[model samples]
Target: MSSAYNHARPPAGAASLPAPDDPVAARLQESARRMAGIAVFSGVVNVLMLSGSLYMLQVYDRVIPSRNVATLIGLSLMVLCAYLLQGYFDALRSRMLCRVATLFDAGLQEHIHTALATLPLRGAKPMLMQQPLRDLDQIRAFMSGMGPTAFLDMPWIPIFLIALFLFHPLIGFTALAGTVAIIAMTLLSERLSRGAAKTAMDLSAQRQVLADTTQRNAEVIRALGMLDRFTARWSRANERYLRENIRASDVSANLGSGAKVLRYVLQSGMLGLGAWLVVADKASGGVMIASSIMMGRALAPVEVALGTWKQLVAARQGIKRLREICKATAPPAAPPVELPRPSRELSVQNLSVVAPGMERPIVSNVSFALSAGMGLALLGASASGKTSLSKALVGIWQAASGVVRLDGGALDQWRNADLGRYIGYLPQDVALFDGTVAENICRFDETATSDAILKAARVAGVHDMILRLPDGYATRIGAGGMSLSAGQRQRVGLARAVFGDPFLVVLDEPNANLDTEGEQALTRAIQALRAAGSIVIVISHRPSALAALDMALVLYEGKAIAFGRRDEVFARVSNASRQIAERQAAAAPAVARRAAAFEGAAS
Candidate 1:
């Protein structure tokens, strides 16, 4: 619930390990090569940028005095071609950048999605779960926007500077001074807006999380008259996000305005200097206008960069987060060793489970072994670690210290995808996806046949109920698909658990929302599972839920207080503590009465 989920960060000052063959990094390197190709187009575009100043130089210096119409027409045609080429190359570079963005995303988006799907099991915070996707989006946007072009154009600034110097030293130095000023402003904008960008990102994440939570619990909030309180919390978060955004925008806008003004002043100064040179017979009048045009071209990239400073900051932050995620995440095992299907037993040795952000273990120092064809009921009160133990057994929550061994191999030894085929679990709170009744039963397994789905439903005694629905097995049912009663949902969940005759099945409070009929179906499902030589574990406090279970484990405050044959455990533990008050009272009064009678006889 909080943002304290352990992300398994690498230790600081740890010895560096060998570099991984990271596909994301490799894709980026390929993108770098694409960016390099665009640089060649950038070079061609910059070269053709001289067309404007050159046209002005020719019209002033050559055509003005000569009064030759044919010469003017020829020069016009040449400059037109130059301008056309320049635009084409500029557009080409932008298109190439977009292609680069597409390729980069196409290669890594699937991997990023997989990482997000398993984030909860890896102990990721609810708010931060979407951050990696946000990072990918930001990077994609930057690559496809004007931001990349500005950065590309920056490297060609010296070309314009060289042209300006060829006009006059004073003009060159003035443009040079203006360039330094714009560069200084760029640096200042980055420094000032860096903190604002990061703060804004944090506030935005908080605001989004609040909005999502409110929507998900909208009915509950309205029922409980809590809308006003939730709105207040959302308002505070939204205000913080807006203020930080405004702060960042102001910095970039101001710097952009300042850079624009400086470019204009520098252009005028360069023109004035060129005019002086012309009058002094050191340069021609044509140089005056040409230098002014060149000055604008020279500083254009810097000005554009200043305008996009906020976007640049966002993209940089995105890259930083992406790197952190990649570094913190462990790569999946390659060609994971396949183990034979488990058929012997399910064993948990000295198991303890500590959830993320908690120092105390929810399930502690518990051990149990169940052979094939056995059924076990885990009995405990509220918060007595029944659910936690069930989750650990099903590999939903990792064991803090212990081994969940299927056959002789630990759960970790089997690949997750491969291990899932032999394990079935129904959580306390049933969550059905937005899919058909058959799809939900088959766990959305596209390869599952109709027979398997029907078998599971029949075993859970939900086959008749499902057939009564409007579309039978094809009926859509879920939060947005179709609403079902709580009892109906629980029975469907039971059917899902027994699909494919899984080797290990764990159900937590399976009968909590069921009717008497559903309860009977649950017991039958457990019996069928055990008959198939599957190890079945049920977590419940209701005795009816344990009707089909022979073995029992009693938990108290996270410890195994008693465990063995169901009748024997209850007998021993009950006789030891069940009637403590009545037994102690009778024994104490009898001893006192005997003492008093003896005293009376002595007297």
Candidate 2:
């Protein structure tokens, strides 16, 4: 166990990645630098894009009029070279964008996973816990697709328009009007579809939550004959999502169609205006055709931009959501202190905890201290705050007020991952990840040794039971240990709680699913843990489990009623109950006689 604990920390001189709080900004900065490089390449590509117009001009103006074969051949070769360069630059920019996306994922994936794991500690519902990863993928896809290229080419629109003006002012003015019209249509599309898009996204998230819940509880739904009800509920949610999605798509499609029509009109109008200019002797036939081509080129990015507007909008929303989540889940600013191994001293100083959205504290002003080699039993009825108190002790739930400390340091003083090395907890819900029994016993620590795994199983007395399986410790368990019986799951969780020489262990309802033999094993596990100089805290409703504990704390309505040696606290509680019973028994005869007299008089 000690060997496993010792190997958990990284070496002192190892290269450290950026802290979780810094990764979002660091990744953004890195991506921006890459985008800057791509932007330079885009400028070159746009410049080379004018090769076709120039080629047309040379062919009609110089080669055709002068009938010079040498000049025509030379111009064709130049145009070919220009197209080749443009193709190369375009491919390079696309590759750069893909690389930027990869870097961004590398920087943030681990941090997002860490936040998701710790979100329950903040009492968050985590309804969309996996959404951020999907959002990251969305951003990556947009960066590599035509959407970003459209934006990059947008600035070159004015350059093309300027070239058209030099050819003939009428052509330039006509093209400018078309550009303004397209811009107006784009804005209108955003205005009409923004609300629908947001609504659709929210509905989709709700549908995902419902689907996840139904899948996880398929057994319960089938057993209770609730399949039809769940299916109907999901169908309604999905229909709403589809309706809003179609509405938003319709608006976008209309705008895209309008932009395409306006683009064609502007191109034809430029040609007609150029012809009129030629007839009026303001320009030649070569200038007429070249000006139309330039006008069409100027408006191309706008057409593409309007066509991919939905992707741009979605990417914008994804960015905003990612920023908000990262901010909300950022770790504390202060670096954690590196403390020595604790001596198993547990202290709770006036601790209070209230459930989320509730005014009443579930555990209020509770204080206790236990030394090494001692075991304390918390005896309470259902909803008596035992589980909440246990959660606070192990640092899963934050205290509303006061502090819980190991040795002499408050829980928050140590880094959570570091503190976790010396503490273990078994929650009421015996959830196990999809893995082998050995992996679960070692808390899924990759560095854990086989000896440590075997020792933990032995301590929990689940070794023989594990061996009975076909693959022994190597047997695979399904998600949430669905493959195991309730008792087996609980026992495996117990082994996990005592895996690595932890100084403080808290088990809530440890024997809830255990049979007679299993309960006896649990008693021995507690005794062994105590004899090893560890502090053991057990929350149990059964009196038999409490027999092995040396001390007891009795609670009622979130208040501690008694705290002392087990026999003393139990005696006080029993005496108080006996007195109340005796008083009630003595008053029963008088009340009965008075009721009889009243009945006799009425008769």
Candidate 3:
């Protein structure tokens, strides 16, 4: 939803293609039209491909026998010109295909990025999701390589066969039979290898996912002595992938070899047949060579196709997956309306959320309302639904039963980009991208001013700490902030959450990794946000982090146990705990007295 995208339109040539409801179909149609232009050049190139055979025939039948130097020279010049034209056409075709690839990427890159960003909300595993960009690269590489050229040359096979018939019917028949046999072999290769190739791709994806997951938690794996176990699991997966890849490659290689041998035999057979015809006064020696040459030309594409079958199959599969992903994540028919900025009145009515693949709701029947200049603390034990409710409020997780609204409008009613500008969220796990400290504090917005970034850093009380880094705001962080300690990363994320003075701020476990100084800064930031008429919601298990909040909500077993003024909810929880403890103390004495009486009676 960037402003630059708001008024963007497709290129003029794309207008001729059918603009179907499916964007993927439309893109493919446009691409095909562009490829059609390249196909025209391919036709010219293939025609020129026959020049070599014709030149040989001219030299043997006319120039050599007549001993005409002028005729030979003329033929040589014409053949040279033909070869040059063929090269030009081939180069043009390659250029056109590259252009098409560039255009295809330009058309789909944004959609793919949007899908990747939104998929996690729908419970997608980031590692398991197919990478459209990589798939796009596969398609482009195939288009610009021999794979597509083989397909383009396939249609010219019959033309070569006709030329062979012109030489002699027997030679033509031999070539035709060779063509059929090669075609059959190509089909066999596809049949034998497709299943294994697909399995290889799937296993490769799984291996990549495992590798990524383990690397992301390298500390835990190393500390717990899980490296050997992980390595064995990875080795097994890699072996399976390798096995499938070898199976597919073996099938393709055998077919390719068979095709080569068949072509050689067929060419030699045509020559022998032509020789017999010449002896029988049915054909000429010049025609024999010409027929063999034409026959070989016809089979060359088949050989190339067989050799590149694996790439072709893989590209086809990649395209299919990309299409499916595009369809699944297509934008809505009508864009959501962009509403005016909210005044930070947050409300949740009977909200419920069930985690992916779980039958029970993680957060159920939770309700709350907070106005501008007010703050709410979400207090709960582990697995008590505090983080789930926080996610629901921020529109990161959809509620199953009810609604979360800002300024009387449901969260879904607002365009994500517009709504995001006024909302800030700090998740339980603080992940900062690899960039400068200022970039992370400013949420990596290119247009953010230095003043805005410094202000947020000050608000989060990390300004002095950042200044102490090697290069201050310009210091580079490693992937996931590996260059910084946990406390530093948490502080930076806190600054990001409050950056831009958002109207609604939600921080989940913000103090989990913070020291005393960081904790105090967080309390002051909450108070400052509330004073600025921003509604702040903090989710924490530590009571110290809740001191500055105006109200509190206690969640127990996915249900709201209490919600009201902060002191009131705290008092209720404290009283409940006191009553339970007293009852336990009274029952302990009675049980001890009973045990004593029973022992005395027995004695």
The candidate that wins on lDDT is 1
TM-score of each: 0.90, 0.92, 0.92
Which pairs of residues have clashing backbones in candidate 3?
none
lDDT of 1 by residue, 166-265 (tens): 8878788888989999899899999988998899988888888899899999999999999999999999999999999998888778888988999889
Candidate 3 lDDT score at position 166: 82
What is the alpha-carbon lDDT for the whole of candidate 1?
0.85
By TM-score, how accurate is candidate 1?
Answer: 0.90
Q: Which candidate order results from sorting by TM-score in descending order?
A: 3, 2, 1
Misplaced by over 4 Å in model 2 are 1-23, 66-74, 334-336, 357-359, 586-603
RMSD of each: 7.1, 4.5, 3.8
